[model samples]
Structures are given as C-alpha cells and as structure tokens.
Target chain A: MAASDAEAPGMRPWILMSPALGAVVLLLAIPICFILVYSFWLRSAVGSEQVGFHLDNWVEVLTDRFYRDILLQTLRIAAISALLCILLGYVPAYFIARSTTRHKTVLILLLMLPFWISYIIRTMSWINILGVSGALNVFLLWTGAISEPLQILYNEGTVILGLVHFLLPFMILNIYVSLDGIDPNLVDAARSLGATGWQAFLQITLPLSLPGLAAGSLLCFVLGAGTYITPMVLGGPRDAMFANLVFEAIITQLDWPLGSALSLALLVILGSVVMLYTRFAGIGQLAKSFR
Target chain B: MDETTRYQRLLERFRNGDLERRTFLTLLGAASLGAGLTGGPLKGLQRQALAATPESVRFDGWGGVVSEAFRKYAFDPYTKNTGITVIDGTFASGDEYLNRVKAGQEGEYNIFHASGVFDYARYVNLGYDVVLNEDNIPNLQYVMTALMEPFRGVTGGKLSAAPYDYGTTGLAYNTEKISKEEMEQKGARILIDPEYKGKIGGSGDWRTRIWYGALATDQDPNDIKDMDAVWDAIRAHRDLALKYWGSGAELMSLLAEGEIYVTEGWSGRIAALQQQGHPIGYYDAPNGYAWQECLMVLKGSPLEACEELLNFMLEPDVAIAVAEGQNYPPSLDPTKVDLGEKIPELPAFDPTGKLAGLTFASPAYWNGNEAEWSKTFGRVQKGY
Candidate 1:
C-alpha cells in the first residue's frame, strides 16, 4: 500500500466518530443548552412560564434556606446509602472473586437477579411485606411475637432498604471485577512473608480495591440522590427528596425554569463530586475496576 | 298520405306524455326525499366548508366509571351526531392535568374537565381557555339554576365554563367498619376526634382537611380566604392522618383493606367505592362540602364543535348517565333521572330553590406557594 492508503485509513477515524458525536450533540448537548437557557428565565405570575429572562430562579434556589436544607438532606441520604452499599457489598464481591469459575458466575447472577424486575415494583413490594396489615406484621401477630401490627413501611428505614436493594448489585459487580483482576500470587507472596492474614489483606487488597469501592460508591450516591420512585413509594410525606421537589416543580407546578435550575444544580453537584473522586482516585483505576 | 300523417302525429303525442309522466314521477320523488337527504348532507357539507375545522374534541379528565359513562352516553352521541371524535386522557390528579395544560400542550386537548376550584381567572388570562357558546347550549337553561349561577362570567355576560357534575366533599367511611351514625356523630370534626385518631386517611390535596377544619370550627368554609388558617388546620390534623393518598384508587384500596376507617373525600368517590362492593358511606355535614368539576373548552377549539359537545353533555339524560356512571349526583333535574334509590336525598342539591353554598379551594392558592406550603407542613409535621 502507498503512503496515501495509510492516510486514507486515518479518515476512517472520523467516519467512526461521526455517529456518536452527532448523537451526543443532538440528544445531550442540545437539551442541556435548552435547559441552561431556561434556568435563567422568569416564571409567569399567573402560571409557570414567563416571556422574559432573569436571574431570579437561580438566585432563589441558591439563596433560599429551604432549598439549601433539602439539598443537604439529599446529600446526606445519598452519602449514607453509598457507605452502606460499600460496607455490605465488599465481602460478597471478594468471595465471588475468590470462588471457582462456575460458582463465581452463579454468585454474580444471584447478585444481579433483582435488577431484572423493575425498581419501582421492588420498592412497592416492601409495602406488601412491611405495611400495617402486611405479611410481616400479620405473621408476627400470628406467631404471638407482637400484640399489634408494626408501622414499618412508610418510613426512612424502608426508603434506605429500597435504595440498598436497588443499588447494592451495581456496587458488588464493580468491586467483583476489580477483585477478579488481582493476581492471586500477590496474596501468596504476602502470606509467604511474616505478614498476618488481616495485615496482608488490609495493606495489599483494601488499598488496591479503593478505586473500585470509590467507583461503586459514586454510582450508588448519584443514583440514590436522583431517585424519586423509591422515596415516593416507600418514604413518608416528611421524607420527600430534592428530586421529588424537582418533579413537583416540573409536573405539578409546571415551572420548567425552576425545575431545570434544580436539575442542573443536582447535575453540577454530582459532577463536582465525580471530579473530586477522579482527582483523589485516578479515573483510570476506576475504569479498570469495572473491567 | 293524410292517413300516414295522422298515425305519425298520434305516435309522437304518446311519446311526449310518457316522457312527461316519468319526469313528474322523478320530481315528486326528489321533493319527498328533500328533508332527509338534501338538508342532512348540505348542512354537513356547509359545516365542513367552514374556515376552521377541529380535527377532534380532545377530552382531558379523570378516568373512572363516570368518565366512561360520559364517554359512552354523552361524548359518543355527540361525536356520532357531529362527526367529531372524543379523545380521552386520564389524569391521576388535578395537578397532573394542570401541568400538561400549563406546559402549553393544551393544543393536544380541546376540552378539559377540571375541578372548578382548580380553574381560576389565571387560565383565562393565560389564553388557555375561552368562554362556552351559550347559543349552542340550550340545555344550559335546564341545568340546576344554583349550579349555573356560579359559573357565569365575573365581569358580565361572558361565561368561561359549563357546569356538568356537582358533588360535596364529605366524609367517606367504610360502612362495614364504621356506621353512618357514628360518622355523623363525629360530624365534620371527625379527623380531630380522639376516637378516629390515626384511623383517618386524607387525600393528598390540602383542600380536604382545610375545609373540614373550617366546618368543624363553625366558620363558613366559603369565607376562609386566609392561607394561614388552611395551613394551621392541615398541621393540626397531620398527626391524625395515616397517609395522604394521591389517587382515588389508592384510597379505595386502603378503604377495602380497612386501613382507613374515615376520611374526607368527594361524594363521587364514595359512591364509586360502594359500587365496587366496598361498603363506603358518605355524610353531608351541616357546614356543607365543596362543589366542583366543570368542563371548559380550550381557547382555539372550533367554537361550533365545542358548543355541540358542551350542549350534548348538558342534556338531562346525558347528565344522569354521567352521574349514575361516575357515582356523582347529576347537576340536572333529579325527576328527569331514573337513578332509583342509590342516591341519598339529604346530600342531594336542594332542588327547592333554596340556596346552599359550599366552599372551594382555587389552584391559585397552591400554584406559587406549594414549595413554601410543603416546607411549612413538612417542618410542622416533622416537629422540627
């Protein structure tokens, strides 16, 4: 082949890149641009939209103590859920990684089984099991474990349970991939030394696994923060999340500008958190953790 | 030669009379068929030839036995007569429907059935809707005069909506669990009553408990113009409420499961639950419940088509069908309806010309203040 032929093959790069680039520009960039434009607009007094542009919506959202408090609450809930997922997911993922090939596949599939059903259905199922007259209470009463049914469904506990149930699989899957990639000989080498089991594992395995744990925690936190259905179905009225407020803004109040501002605020916060994670824990390591 | 000419002349004469008789017969037939054929098609063609023709009549409203009944009896008949299709869209809440309208997707629907409480002057101000054509609705005259009076244009002769269904917001109790007498004895103050504490389940809307608070306190519910009072009332009963159900279906399920013994709800919903084999009962307190649900046409609908549908829905038989089907009392002459004994007489709109008014909550109250209200209620309820 001539030099021109090699250069012609380079043109194939653009050809391959065009479809994804076009899709991103059309689907993501354009909508985000529209939302950016709307976030600065004013809401009509009579309804939810106005014909004029202003910084009122942003100022209101930024300065309002109510929105600030909810934002904090949302972050707190998400952080807690992420921490819980990490603590709960690590052991199972490590076990799965150390298992035989067939056992590993079965264990991974078991972790993934819940995702096959809808998240909403899974969340609502808790109601059937935990509600005032639901199965758990009925069973407890029948067994003489309690005189009256317990009020367990519509509370923060149920919300957390639902979040953990929906998100733990993703965490486990990420951590499992990271652990699977580790050389078993490294553990043997550590064991060959005077290092104890706990010491070797902590010094070698845990630090190396931090990238995967961070990546898993990030996924859980972003999802937990953005989740509306689980909270709406499982949480009580007082447990309304920031996303639910955004939903009410867009769907109930028809305030698109404010809704857009709220959504963008959430995105910015999540993006910042991800950026921070990327800085502290290399993004490349995070990527390999999912490999 | 003379004999031949005479024979030819007679033959010509016979041919002319036969042709004349055939022409006369055709003319007589066409004249007799005139009213049925010419008037019908000609009028239709004239309507079709109009400058602006609606593609269809989009009906955005709640879905249930009532809406279904309205579609079957009223909406279908109108479409059949006028060649317009009724597009049915169901909403889980008034807020949801209003959101669609506010999004400027009002073009997707031509007619919307909304609570009169939710439809304020703002809708008119926003150019989302227009006044109903009185000329097309002759049955508007037959609508119970009380229901008609409230919907008339505020300024003068212009009217924004046509009244269709009227029912009071009252206490709905599972009759199997709680008796009618017991509910009535608790009266409008049932939610706050120590006996019913934690047993009451309220619809998520703030209007239900707010009005009940007004009634229980002997203040006229209609006169509750202050927002503070409404908030206070809601906060007071927040502890007593089991949950704020977002839909009638959810409430019905709760009632069926005996999770809720009593709660404030629309009479139509109670009636619907009763039909579904749930032993639900409704009581009309002395303070009276809110009356709502009116049909309004979007601003740009073909006036003639909208008027026709509006008129058809207002017809006495159609009203009765909607009421009986939806479990709501019809806003028409009760004597004209064969409702049997299912409808209670005391809760019925006073047909005797005596004016009994009910309090209503406008969407304006919650439009801007929902965030604040939600925060306030959340804070107070959480005891923060």
Candidate 2:
C-alpha cells in the first residue's frame, strides 16, 4: 500500500499494528506506570497501605545500605551468569549451526527438551542432585570418594549454577540463530589466506555473530537478575535477591507502596544495563539478531 | 416427585382448609428466609434443607493436602449434613487472602483460614473481621479456653474468630539422629549448637527466627520490637544453621532426605513430614514458638451460615477429624477431643493451660520494622 501511495500517512501502517501495540501498552506500560505512581505512596504503621505521596519508600530503597547491597549482589549474579552462559552456550551453538539442516533440527529439539517441564520443577531437581543427602552425595559415598557429604546446595555457587542451568538454552538458541545466518565461505576465505583456525574464527565468524552474543547475553542477564525462585530454593540465607525483597513488601508485609518502589528501582537498574549495552552495540544490531 | 416437598404438603393442607391462611403465610415467609437469621423455625427448615439446597458456603484455605483435609473433615461432612455445598478455594498467604477480600474480589469466600492468630489482630484492625454470633455457634462452648476467652481468653469478649488449629514452632530433630533429651537441653539455642553444625534448617520467617533467638536468650519474644536483639542472638547461632530456608516444602525436603540432622520447624509441617514416614520428632522445649491458626469470617459476609460452619467445626467428632486430617492440635477444648492415636504428641506439644509459657509472637509486634528486620537478618544469615 505504501509503495502504491507514496504520499500516504505513516499512521495508516501503525493502525494495522495497533492491536499488538495496544496489548503491549495495556500489559506492560500501564502496569509499570502504575507501579511508578505507587512508589511514592506511604505504608502505614498497621501494615495497611494508603494512597498518599511520600519519598520515604524511595529513600529507604536508595539510601539504605542493605537494599544497596542486595541491588549490587543482584547485578553481580546476573553479570556472572550471563558471562558463563555466553562461554558455555557458544560452543554447542556454533556446532549446531555448522551441522547439516536435518541434524540441526534434532539438535535444537534436544536443546529445548529440558524447557518442556516447569522452571520450579527443574530447580527442585537441582536440589535433589546437590543437597547434602542428594544424589551427588549418595553417589560419592557409594563410590567411597569422600568420608563426609558435601554441603553444595544453598550457597552462592549453587545459585549461579541454577541460574545458568535455566538460562543456557536461551543463550544457545540466540547465538545459533546469528551463527547460522553467516556465510560458511567467509571463514574458508580467511583459512585459505593462511589464517589459523582461531584467527579465522576471531576475525570473521566471531564478529559476524556478535549480534547473537549480545542478544543472548542480554537475555540471560535480564532473567538472571530478575529471578526469585532459583536463589530462594537453592541458595542459603545470604542468597536472597531483589525480587524476594519486593515479594515480602507486597505479599508478606502488605507494603505495596514500598514494594512498588523496590520494583521500579529494579527496573531502572535493569533498564540502564540494556541502555548502556545499546550505546556500545547499538539496539538496531541486537534487534537484527532475532531476524 | 414420589412424596413431593415440604412446601407441597403445606400447599395441600392450605388448599384443604386444614391450615389457616395467616399460618400458611407465616410458614411460607419463614421457609423462604432459610438459614439467613439462623435462630427459630427457619433454622429447623435449614436442617431439613441440609441435604439438597442449592445454597453453598465457600472456604479459602491453604492449598495442597491441607486444603483437601479441610474439605474432608470440616467442609465435606457439613455439606453432606446440610445441603449447602461447600466450594473450596486455596490461598498461599494471609496477606494475599486479606488483600483479595479487601479489594472486594473474593465475594465468594466468607470463612477464611487467614494466616495465624497474629493475623486475626490485623483482620480486626483492618475491619475485615465480623463479630461472631456465639448463639449460632453454640458448640464454641467446647472451644479451648485460651482461644474462647475475651480477645482469646477462656471466654467473654468480642469474639470475631474461631480458632481451628495451632502448632508449636521450635527445634525438632530426626529421632534416629539424636534423642529428645539431647534436643531439649539445646532447645531453641540448638541453632548455635556446635554439634549440629551445618545440620540445622529453618524457613526465613523473621518472626519465628526472632522468637527462636528470644527463647534461646531467655527473653520474651513478644516484648521485643526491634530485631536488633533478635538478629544479634541469631547471628551468634548462625553457624549452627545451614541457610535460612524460603519455604516449608524446602525445609521438609531437607529433613525428609536426611540432609540435616536437627531441624528448626513448625509442628504442623513436622506432623506432615512424619506421616510421609520420616523419623521426625519435636523436642518438648519449655520455651517454644507457637501461633494459633484461626478461621475468620469477613465482615458483611453471610453470618448465619458462616457461624454455623465455625460451630460445626467445634463439635468433638468434627474437631478430632480435622485434627487427624491436618495432624495439628485442635484449637477446640482439649477435653472434648479424643487424641488417643492420631497424634498422641499433640496434647503434650500444645500448651492448652499454659499458653503463657510459650513465646507468643503478636501480629502487632511482628509487622513493625520488617525492612530493618530483613536487612539485619539477611546480613546475619550470611554470617556477616
């Protein structure tokens, strides 16, 4: 239609997309805006929340040393998990991208199989394998590998492992999509010019696949940062994350205003990470990864 | 169609002139009233309608088997006796259910197992609680004295809730791992017990953790407002704990799998685990953590039917059935309940006459300073 009528208003095309756009605004924007408003409301002494504007909740979130630590810890965990996902996911993704089309379908299916089950069930399975009397311990004892059971579950390390385990597939799929788009001859050209395998990959395939790497790492980072269950179930006391604090404020403590403030603070932190990444990698580049 | 309904007989008698028009009208008005104002002739009709009326009462309860047990013991039988079918809904937390009711979204559920006794205070403060009609709940006479009393005494003061089930929270151990005698000596202080290093477990409920620290330190749990003292105590005992758990199921899994030798838990959950064939045993510590779980009807709810439901739960047989189903100590009068076999340790565990002995955490006391509590406790749990 636009090709036929060059003078047509851009609004006509947007009208066609309005239904999807309306849903995004309704489900995402309206709720986030509401949370932004509630962030200023006050929580009363008796655990009842009222609609009054105040900065106390914000001050508590931003100023308090504890909230600061939790926020920083959340960022730290997400960054590490995303970095690990990139490292772990890149190999399988590259191999899958290099496979025959018939094999690629089976490989991708196998990669996505674990996700068919619930996320919580997958996390609990880790508990069964990692806990003191869990499968790992029983196996180790049966093999006479150690005199005592190892306390592997409920620690910072286990929390990271859980996050990476949940997120590895997403990272793999994203990287594979970008890697699969590359022309196979580009790397062969470098190899014919006497470039080593590592050098050819570093110069050609890696640069081309940067879009997928950025997209997958960003996805992993966002999910890892926002996760509530993995750490809560597998990690010890110190493993409590920003989501848990938000959970307590709204659900347990009945302090919606404070919870809303905490939620917005988390969104700001996560949003800024995306924005900063976009500044360097460009949003257009990352969006093209999905294509 | 075989014998027609009571209304049919009334109509036949009226048409035959055996019944006066005034009498017929009065009878008709009373019959239509049903169980609305639950006293007098209307109630007798309700007893007749108990098997087939379309009227149904809904209960929002904690989910999983606990909700099923509530249906089997209290709800299902009540429906069978009275035609009012019981509709069941499940909730995860008290604040969640209260918020739903407060928002006017849950018009369907009148009677709710809203958290513990502490939450009852919040309900009253929030004006969500209805003044219970003790006349309708005659069997409240059999309710435990401590729960029935004025504001939860032996009796007489603005009763708003029917205390159903309560359990003790304190140090428990795998009997195969340690004797009760050894556990008692450690008591709540067992959190810091060196012998159980990396073997202790508890959920991350600040109130119970505070009570644990208070009991261990010989301080009144309810009296303390700030968790500074609570956390300091827990920090000292931090080494004994594995990690602060987030859910009962998580802690139970730890216990059931023998991941931990000593467990910090609630008696309700311990009972659940024991039924699953775990050798779980609670230490009868002198100072313990206890909360009375009550069923509260929301204000402006159908009071007549709600009160009757509460009263039915108080009956000796019904109370025992509930007690057996949940494996929690009956909140009704202990004398009325037969605790012969289902849960022998319940009576010994719950302090019917000596509620004062246990550290009762007040809702008012618990709500204050949660942010600070979590902040301090978070650091403490990390051994900071």
DockQ top scorer: 2
Candidate 2, superposed: residue stretches over 4 Å from native: A1-8, B1-56, B80-83, B99-108, B150-156, B225-228, B272-279, B337-340, B347-359, B362-384
Please tell me which predicted candidate would have the highest TM-score against the true structure.
2
What are the per-residue Cα lDDT tens digits for candidate 1 across B249-337? 77776676667788877777776677678778888787766665777776646677888888888877777767666666666655444
- For each candidate in turn, the TM-score is 0.79, 0.85
Docking class of 2: acceptable
Kept native contacts, as fractions per model, are 0.37, 0.56
Q: lDDT per residue, candidate 2, B1-384, as tens digits?
A: 322267667777988999998887777666646445554444434433332223777788877766766676778778878776778888766667766765552234578885566677777766666677789988777767775453453123677788777677766689998887778777777777777778777767766777778777777777765546667778766666776765667668788887787767777777788778889887646657667777787764567777778877676676676677666777765456555566556633453544555555665566555545654565566546
**Model 2 chain A: lowest-lDDT 10 consecutive positions:** A2-11
**C-alpha lDDT of all candidate models, in order:** 0.71, 0.75
